[model samples]
Target: MDERTRADVERAEAALVEHYPHLVRLAHLVLPPSMGRHRKVLTAHGLVQRALPWRAARRAAGALPAQRGPDTAAGYDLVRQRTLELALAYEDRRRPAVLLPTVPFVWGLRLFPRAGGADELALDQALSAVPAAVRAALGLWQLEGLEPEAARAVLARAGVADPDAALRAAGQLDRRTGAGAAALLAAGEFDPCTVHVRPTDLLRRRQRARAAAALAAVLAAGAVVAALPGGQPAARPAPTAAQQALDPGRLLRTPNEEWVRTSRVDFTAWPPRGRQAGDRRLLGRALRVWAAPPPGTRIVAAAGTSTRPPAEPPRLLYAGLIDNVMVVVFHDGERLVRYAEPEGATPTLHFARTDNADLATAGALVIGRGNGWQRYLIAPWVAGVAVRDLLAPDAPPHGLHLAPDGVTDRIPLPPAGGGPCGHWPATELRTSARLESHPAVLVTDLGDLAPVHLAYAAAPAGPAAPGEANGAPALHSWARTACTLRSLRGTGVRSVSNWVYARQPLPEGGGTAEWVCNRAETWRGPGRAMVQFEPPAAGPADPGRIAGRATGTAVCGPYGRGVLGGVRWQAESGTWYLLAAGGGRVDGIDVTGGVRAGADAPTLAVPAARDAPAEVTGRLPDGGTVRALQP
Candidate 1:
């Protein structure tokens, strides 16, 4: 039976390899060009990954025989449909301001490359003008060959209000774009007949690189390690008597157990500089777009230095807000700098080379707050530090103490005291991580901290869930678990600057909220540690009650996994209420509420119950009588 299961898995894996690129192309066609091709590929891959579980579940339920392989076509269709749904939801929040032309389809075009020719450029321009929803409809119907009814279903799933209008707009877009190409397409005279590079071609390229690296590691395993990306680390001068007493590693630590810091960096040091009156105007616009300015407070711009502007123009820094955190983007000629700041706090900077030839290669590093501490997400090239003492802030600083088990010589990370920049340290380097290639280097001038060089040669890709090989905790798994424990929802990987602005629905109200996620983290104060752990406050003066019928079902699986499934709800109470499910000692409600309702709520818990539906209830703040019927 085990052998059969392994064979079945292999079959499923083979199917995935065959269908992955088509899935990616389908995703790209439907999603906005601005989302970038890397994002499209990731979305496509994630959708396909999600489908694998469902496919496996069906096989377990005997929907398919163990000997029979899963249907690749059906799976790909499901993946495409999901991508469309996600695209539609994404489009709702970030509607394109203008329509753009659909670009020329080529087999080997660079991922995320801008349109090159007149035809492709015109297509992008035309498509940009169309509403995102409409563009999605066109991609679904024309490109994916979805029936109108199926297109409507996709739109409906995405909560699009006017699917018909979207379809009409798709037709309108074709008419307005180049008449010759449009006519050819309409006449079915033009077909992009070329097959893209096969998935095996990519696999072979990666395999050859890996084989070469393995051979090199075997040949030079005992040699002196090469310099990190930042070059050879500088020698540290003798520490002062007072400085030597303090551990550099402890600097980034929470003072008195504070999860976050209060001190703000003085942005005035390199005061924002504007070149022209128009630059000042643009700066104001950027501030308005990225920051929530106080009603009447005027914003000003300044320069980083007094020197006149150089002939080679500095890149305009893009700005946006993510979960109230400010994101500032600027590209030096060589590298991209993404700076993030909490409200009124100094910024933390992450810099990476802008020279990624392959979109699949890691070109970006993300530093954002997670679970009351800073979290770093480096691309495959950047390695996490295995330090025994202080190094730098941006290289996996949060879970420093939780290094993978068996790491006896782990290096301690640099102090998190000052923000990402400033003060102390000549050069810090870590030469070992089970997964790292070269050393990870943090090169700084003795005192100046404004722009420290964080450089490390590219590292090989390791298991996404680290420490799973042994019994130790996994970094990626723990990060996700910690985020979920703090009620951070929909935590998943993303592509782009690795930064994306998105909307999350409020758990209580029916209302939705626009926020940022990919490469961003909302800084919630210290987690369970900050809670007072006191009993509920005395009842409010105005009493309230919630009484309703809650007909929900339950199912229990093996291994003590009980689920409250097929649950549906309707609210009898006129007022909003906090709802939860309880049975035995199991707790399914949070302090805020089990599940809050704007006017109604649903069963959102899997409270353990033996062979029965869990008892679900609703309550008001004043300790009012709340009852529910559970059949």
Candidate 2:
């Protein structure tokens, strides 16, 4: 073989056939997940298949990566190099690699790599956090059994700018993970060869097919029309462009009386109410910069939100000086885009999807946040505003000065998260139409388009029932639950609801204690919930610790009418008691493991050894069983 020539065509094909599974697995591991699961699987296969020697160019080779295993043919190395290069290119940010198989789609029934254990999940998540180059290097080193230098050389050949730094980062990841990269990789997590098959939604599949056919017909007609005459398409500004090319005059405007006239009370009905609402220059700059932000501008979109230009001419929500910075909000049916420009500072833009949002979740927007204080652009129907600390239930809510523009004065926010529970303050909005004021609704910011509505369930209400935050018990119930919100910061949460499922009479006359579930729902589909057991205390601030917490669960959501939670409590005499309680839906309770006990009622109290592990199971009225929430 010529030193310059990478590999012979016949030899390369043979080598690829012999090691097809390994190559596909490596490609799958290297490809970024931004393309989504099905696309990633298909793209990985396509990359391997297209890596034939005669068809693909040789990867840059100052020095070839070290060969491992029994077969060390240069043909294997050639295909491997090409596959790595293509896989790196397939990652987000660089360019498209159109090596998709042209034959029948393999994923007509949604195909995905087989699910792995916890270690594999952690490894996959860790890989997702790093650059594609780093992930490639790690995959080569661990899955391919290559030396560190060999992996670095391969990464450099594949056009990774800083291969040495990538190798170093890969090393750091290996150390940080709970298990070794090699051990985790051996779990078949990145194996595209072995996969799980699930059918796509049949109805959605049919709808998509019709939609695609219609789109193709439209495109064909458009092409024919464009070729015949002066049928130039309209020029739309590129969203990520660094220059302000979009005309600001195209921005949409609405009358101030639109709120009263429109039947909708959400963002659509929000009228322009800022002092700078009529400032054409400021509004123009804002719109232009949003379409084409400058180099220094910072852009952030919440999870599950789109990173695209406005689908429609965005209607003005509010435009004014908020906390000394000019802030502008726009709603275009899908999302709420906010643009803020501080004096002598580069502009900052934010986007959050408001899909499926009702008036309760979209009532208020946090326009400005800084210095432990936040300013809100409230709904026009909101006649007055007040601030109250959830932890301080006895304290009266102090009225906040609401400007005619519907922007509230800078109000102090809740205490910072990740600390011991303290004051949890919230904005209280009052509607003007109702003379007998409705129960005060407390809304708190969780870094989204709208503040998350806080719901609480007090006594006399069922486990599934929730009410507004006005009573003393509701405040105390929330105080125990508010500390968990700190974990939800920047998670694009839509709402945080608390429902008291059951009250258990503590063993040895420890008095009545409440069990509540605080669940945080996010716009990104998945949500987390925590069940806490609150002991009877003299004051509202006496917090209860978390009994159980879980992710990807609807333990306290609409569907989960029943919730079971347990706490190992020590009575005044220092005897340990396993106390468990369930909502109304639970007909009986069962205690397993060290403390074996059963209760005909919803509540269970059993004497148990100190620090003994036990599982609490609840039997529902309908004969369905429910386990206690787990971390």
Candidate 3:
């Protein structure tokens, strides 16, 4: 090499060494705290060393004019950009492929703790919850002092189309936190210094794999190495069932035992001649039956950047459990739509696009849980179109006026029972179908476990007799029993309100009246609940006059929709009545499972491959008329 070139390289190397500590600190802020400090430092070192502009300056020596003469500011911005890129890649690779379907709707500043009160743990969860591109955009603009357009360019490099929107959202999130990004670095109640640093060979992992492969090849080729005396390796033992169960990769694919046969609904039967275009019941049933897998299968859902051309690669449109069935829908680029019923192992064609406009631009609607998630073709054309025209195959599609502020097609669904089906209230649909589209599947621990009946034998010598006027004591005993049951079943109890003074609705023409005691709780997996006291005799309902062991549990399904059943004590009537109210909003008519008049009701089963729905008998202690549920 020429003397001038060699000198330039040396100068660049010296500058890099001097700036190394600052670069590492910058990387630490941009990357997840889950990655240990050692790796962060190493990754930062590498990024700085590889920055193209910096590298060019080093190699070309006197080719580029010096900025600020030997100041670290020279090419520092370029180094920061490169560091941001590396940090983004690092975060993307670490994110789990499967995500809870509720994330998009639940997305808000609540996911992040206030930056002023932030610690490593809160920051980690917040970062994991948000899109990596959004996080990177925030890092570039806020931490690296890059301009909005410059940050957008960096985001564009990472395949984010609407960088401005992403940045705006990030800014809003930051503002909502009422704290700057530095809050994540601030020491709070928890000491950041004491954090356990796990050693990782991230940069060398690939090299290690390659070396292992080469060694295996050598050993297969009959190569042997001399070993010192007593240097023999210890024998490794096989993994036990428990160890296998704990393996993180084990649930990537559904277990064979978890597969169940699914029921099918013919497509031709839907949209009855007089049915409205947006019938909520039809929409719910159609999506549920179309997208749901067999009763027992758990769903495995994933979404990310895709290279499939012409239109964007398909993304997860919906993932949820409808009536305990796993349903998943895809926002696909492919013009052909397909459905797979339990009886059919392979998906058959459902809809084929023949319109001049691209169907890829508009997103799809979804209903159901887990493997039962079904997608609704809300918009078949890029331009906005009316629902009736979009659904009619013979009608020419009309142009839709796309909203300017990110909100696109507003496809309204028919309100069944006075409410939209499946509790999905979002009407403003936006397009996130490109490679940047992030799709997620919701998988709960309660696959399809039918809600188990939890009962407590009346405790002796409590504040009041089990059948006495004081209901709090008996309800309290039942609640403890329920808590124990919850613990044994291994389900998480998100929240519980016990024995609070709330009104319980009496059967028949009774108006709302205050109750002496009530209990409720939100649960994870399959069921959530609300507990109320019921009076035995019908007529003017009186909470104060209510007697006997008359407590009923309103069990909710995965998405806060569920059935109201269990024993209702009516002291006045002295006769037991079996009651079952449909699952879903009490105000809405879209009932999932309900019992009217003495008719037989279906058990609440979580669609499980092997577990059948738990049988339940909603027997009330004598008297009072049973309420009929509206479909």
Candidate 4:
């Protein structure tokens, strides 16, 4: 029996249903433009519907994949490959065709996708001029974010005669400089989920309508003469207009005064402040799309957040044009919703749950994100914004400009800890309550929908005493672990605080080193801690390796500061020793396994084997033992 998992009919069905619009779009783009707009639209939808494998077909196919191979057959991927193959076959004149119109064809209606801008038209024309295989490769690259190599592989599996040559041909076309292929594909011209309907042959339709009406009148007159059994309809009152299920006008609006009285400085406190906030039509569209999103709509939701529609009309947090794109934000008590539609591009919406939120977590939101920079919708309380490089602690922060709508300029990001992170960039936001200025906090984007709070605090001083983070010791502590943050990149983190938990003197005349614990709190209600032992490094810029990390344990917080970490060290005299340290929660340290050692105090240093593996634990003042966290 084949051990490799094969695509089953059930999973394929779900994928086809979920991604029907996207699959249809791919088929439509791959099909020839020679088929004309209406024919292509119908045929694309038909091909995608037919891509699903029946149970019998799946059983017959056995262990074989739908063409992209068994190694990577995400149900959607399987159907996608199958759809492309069918489209390619349908376009080929030699093969017998399978015509399917899942949606009944309306003879009097002409359907076409909404037209896009000049760039989209040019892109469509260029794509249409290429071979079907080439168009498929380009669509995969532009829409699916597949690289050329991956696109080539997918094409080869879909039975392309020469994928490399097809890609080369498509590459030769002039995609305007600075115009991204993915962004161009997002234009309205390509989406078939929603189409423009026009009456076909208007003159002929009018003639036919008149004939049908005459026939219907005669039939009704004959029926009335034969029956005479109808009772007088009771005096009826005129019907009132229906309150739309989610009326944009009926949406909950919080009074501006609510912000002043309420302690909650979250989305609920935000008053409608934008030039186009009163635009009913734009708001209605946003609300409608949120309640029942079309299959073509692109949605991004954070981890652990439910995408269920609001039970009641969501509160209008903000409605305005930001950086030329129309954006609308809604607060549904627990979650935050954002809708955006760039000019000439298809609409996209994203949201995240912000339950149990506070001022710091709700400080800034990512209104728009791009390759290297991201624009944030800063909270109203933020009086000033500045950019600071955490690596350069002594350097003054530069001003960050915000638009009238509270959307900021494209703030460039420092390189995520992919390599040697020589510089760490963060935002210093000055937030004030009603009247007085408050100490600023540094925040950074960690691939979350919102920027998370970043700060460093030393244990003896406690978590960054107001203005203390800008001081030398606090900045030094943060600088050591700032680059190490790359490991937590892309997590749905809401806030991260780094603090020195303990200070210990090393053995064999080695200098005193700081034991720090960095804790990160995520929007999903979980926290992670990274413990590091920063020995007397060559320079202040050095970020020491992680000593240990733990989840669900408050190893370095105000409540439970118990943490034990051990590392091998070599003195200037070339003698090796195992150095162990613990925070204030523990009174004793014990090292076991490959190295055997114990200390009466919170610090331990003993001569041991070079490059040894040891288990370290701590004994609290009350005699309770705590195991050390691991790497």
TM-score of each: 0.28, 0.60, 0.32, 0.64
lDDT of each: 0.33, 0.76, 0.34, 0.74
lDDT per residue as tens, model 1, 1-631: 1123433455555655676555444445555443434334344445445433233332365455555555556445544555555555445555444222223323323223232343444455556456668777776766667888888887776667899998888877766555433332322111112222222234434555796998697546434333345444345457554332232221111122111122221111111111221233333332332222222122221112111111222343334443455554443333344445444322344433333212122222232333222322222222333321121222333323321211112221232322332212222233224332433433221111121222111001111111111111112111111211112121211111110111223333434322111111111111110000011113111111112112111111011111111223222333322333321112232222333232222223222222333334433334432333322
Candidate 2 vs candidate 3, lDDT winner: 2
Give lDDT tens digits, candidate 3, residues 1-631.
1133333444455555666555544554555443433333344445555643422323354565433345444345545555566655565644334121221221111111122332344444455445556667666666557888888887786556578887987786566443355455333312222234332334344545686897697555442332545554445457655334333233122222121221211111111111122233433432333333222222222111221111222323333333323333332333222222322112221332211212121232223212212223332211232222111223332333543211124333221222212221112223224323422110111111111112111212211211211133433333222222222222322222223223334444344433222222223222233434333324221123322122223332223222333333332334333323332223221112333233233212112112222223332224212222111
- Give the Cα error of residue 117 in candidate 4, in Å: 32
List runs of model 2 lying over 4 Å from the truth.
Answer: 1-250, 434-437, 459-465
Deviation from native of the Cα of residue 286 in model 3, angstroms: 34
- Per-candidate Cα RMSD to the true structure, in Å, reads 28.4, 12.0, 20.2, 15.2
lDDT score of residue 52 within candidate 2: 80
Tell me how far the alpha carbon of residue 81 in candidate 3 is from the true structure, in angstroms, after superposition. 2.8
Taking all chains together, the TM-score of candidate 2 against the true structure is 0.60
Per-residue lDDT over 531-567 for candidate 4, one digit per residue giving the tens place of the 0 to 100 score: 8889887777788878789886655655665777777
Instruction: For candidate 3, give the lDDT.
Output: 0.34
TM-score of model 4 vs. true structure? 0.64
Candidate 3 similarity to native, TM-score = 0.32
lDDT of 2 by residue, 1-631 (tens): 2233333555578789999998998888888654556667777888888888554345476956333334547778888998998888765445564455553256447667778875687678678667788888888888888998888788888889999998899899999776688887767667888888876546545656796998798789778878877788546546532222244455566666565666565777777768887788988888867765543355778878875655446777778887667998888777888988865446778898786776566678888876456788888667779988877777888999987777788877665434446677788887656324456678887666578888887534653557776678777777667766777867788878888878888988889998888878888778788888889887777778788888897677767757888888899998999888887478799988878999998899998987887889999888899998764
Off by over 4 Å in 1: 1-19, 37-55, 58-76, 89-116, 179-631
Cα error, candidate 3, residue 393 (Å): 42
Whole-model alpha-carbon lDDT for candidate 2 = 0.76
